[model samples]
Target: MQVDADFRPILGPQLVRLDPMRIKQLQDPLVYSSIDSLAKLSAHCLNLRAPLTTCEKLINSDNTLYLAWKFDEEQNVSRLLGFAKVGRKQLFLYDSQMQTYEGEILCLLDFYVHFSAQRQGVGKQLIDYLLAQEHAEPYQLALDNPSVTLLGFMSQKFGMSKPVWQNTNFVVFDELFQSFAAENGEKAPDGWNRPQTPRRIGAVSTDTRWLRNAVSGHQSKGNAMAAPVDADMTPQGALSNRAHQAKARKAHILSSKPLW
Candidate 1:
């Protein structure tokens, strides 16, 4: 893919894609120092121990693509605003009917925006540019341990709220399954059922243990905590009970097996 050019005008002056060959440019004190500052900023935003990607790793890895967003300042100076690191990896899903696992998919490894530059639509612009360049849609790609902020952005921007449950750490949306199945020459039967309504934010939880426990509790009682429902139960208690039951029902398909 092409690198060292501005992909989006509104975002900044430059959006460079770094590879093994061009990564050496980061060794210069001016360039590498700015990247370190951006990395520290990103780590603060995500509450991470350190930056997920370093100049050393980018210079060595072949499978990863590093896209940096930069802004040209006065006197021909430039600043690193933020960056996104994406890597292609296999995505696996369990097919209950076939009792097996399916693979071969692309995933987003890491994405971040400097805290100072956030809320300016920089992240959305970056992702849009990347998707267009790759000729891929958001639903066709999976995410690896996405932060809550990223999840909220995806839901609001791309409607990526509903995810197909899988017994793996990687999270894939429902659309990917259909796309992959079609590519593998598998077609759905006529009159196949599908969701009737659009997915809402926070409708599904990725925590398998919480889902499993909620399901078991719901089947036996009305709430995950198994609290007794009586005349003394307040409206809030009743509402909580109902919510737990709903989560259990939604998680039924995924709770059947462990995510090991």
Candidate 2:
């Protein structure tokens, strides 16, 4: 993503973290425009009707976007290589053992690497940076409507082979449940199978993104991995999108799972 003006002075030649407060403090239109443009492009790449990420959502939500930059000395221009947006969200999550809980969990919102940079480890670098910052393992995180490509990435990079499907766009891995069980007693406490029954390991500041989108049609009832339905990455279903209400159009579901 190229901007008219050089951003090396503002962003430098390193990965930059952008959040509501950081963006506000900078008050730079170029930064906003560049971010918005990259989001639009990412949405387009994911075959979405609208951009999943927007300036308004970032301002209102507790999302953090990490921007990977590339500075061309000859061109004297700084361009965005990729970005990964993540945040802590309170969600009704189902674990691998069919247990349900409500808590503020870290989520991978959006990830994108430019076409020119794909397969060059840029995407991995971005995700690694996110994990390092959050001090989290890949299996312990929830994915918002992950696309097929993203699913493949997880399978290949982190061996997250099993994903516990939820009614909403979010999905969790079996290891998360194992981790929770190991941390809180030997297994999920009795009555944890019911919706929002058990408490998570701990609490954190959670964003209200799901609650805000509850009224929308995209938050359809039932398991997202079930067959004959549209794709899974509805909210932030793809590597490029996250947290926004997915389009109503029917297309392909990346993969299906049992109606748990």
Candidate 3:
């Protein structure tokens, strides 16, 4: 299922459903070790901030199936927004083989927007697109973001009901959901599509504080907590991993003496 291309731009980025054809775009080793690992990290952070847990797992023991959404633009091929998905096992655990009595359970497992894209409509658009999918059950959406106000706005505007209080975050429900119209009161700004705007993301918003604090605190705390992770260098582990790899390659070339 897909929305019209015209509407896609207004949504800031188009939400492309994850399938074998499109999965490669979502698997960015730079941002995530595996798409599976990215989902787990997204879950962990959302849980830490919202303090809720639904016991969702992004990767199965066998590592067989995966699902996700990748947001992208028409003009800029290199520029991308973020991706989200649900592992098959996570769906099973959450509903016991899809026996959800309440509503259709769609878990937002992994979500990331380029820092440049935060607070833009990327997330909202993704959620909106998900809601518009074909479901055999009622519309139940679960995510652990600590966006009480935005979630509340979404609940009201998109017909989602109140979110259930979980340990780490809230799981919201909606019987009838649709793509957000610009007229919707909870519409997110199109700042993401705009370039060269100096916007302080978390300043006026409640959602920003937690992320800003988490990142700031993580950086200030230094590499001690992250040293172990630093050892296993995945393509996506470090901010400068690509550059470091390039430099190492250059150094190797310089140090090695060539024989004629």
| Predicted structure with the largest lDDT when compared to the true one | 2
| 209-257 per-residue lDDT for model 2 (tens digits) | 1211122122236534322433543334553343232331222233343
**Candidate achieving the largest TM-score:** 2
The lDDT values for all models are: 0.57, 0.70, 0.38
Off by over 4 Å in 1: 1-13, 25-27, 66-68, 72-77, 95-101, 165-167, 182-260
TM-score of model 1 vs. true structure = 0.58
On the 0 to 100 scale, the lDDT of residue 237 in model 2 is 56
* lDDT by residue (tens digit), candidate 3, 54-154: 11222222211222234335532333454545422222111211211122235554455444566767656666555565342223445644456546645
What is the number of backbone collisions in each predicted candidate, taken in the order shown? 0, 6, 10
- Model 3 lDDT, full chain set: 0.38
TM-scores for all candidates: the values are: 0.58, 0.69, 0.36
Please give the distance, in angstroms, between residue 112's alpha carbon in candidate 1 and its true position after superposition. 1.1
Sort order, TM-score high to low: 2, 1, 3
lDDT of 1 at 14: 62
1-260 in candidate 1: lDDT tens per residue?
A: 11233324323346666656666754465455556566666777668997777767677775354455554433343445567777665443533232222344556777777665678887788788778766779986677777777778888889888765555666667655545456543432333322211111133312111100011113123334544433325678668879976887768757885322
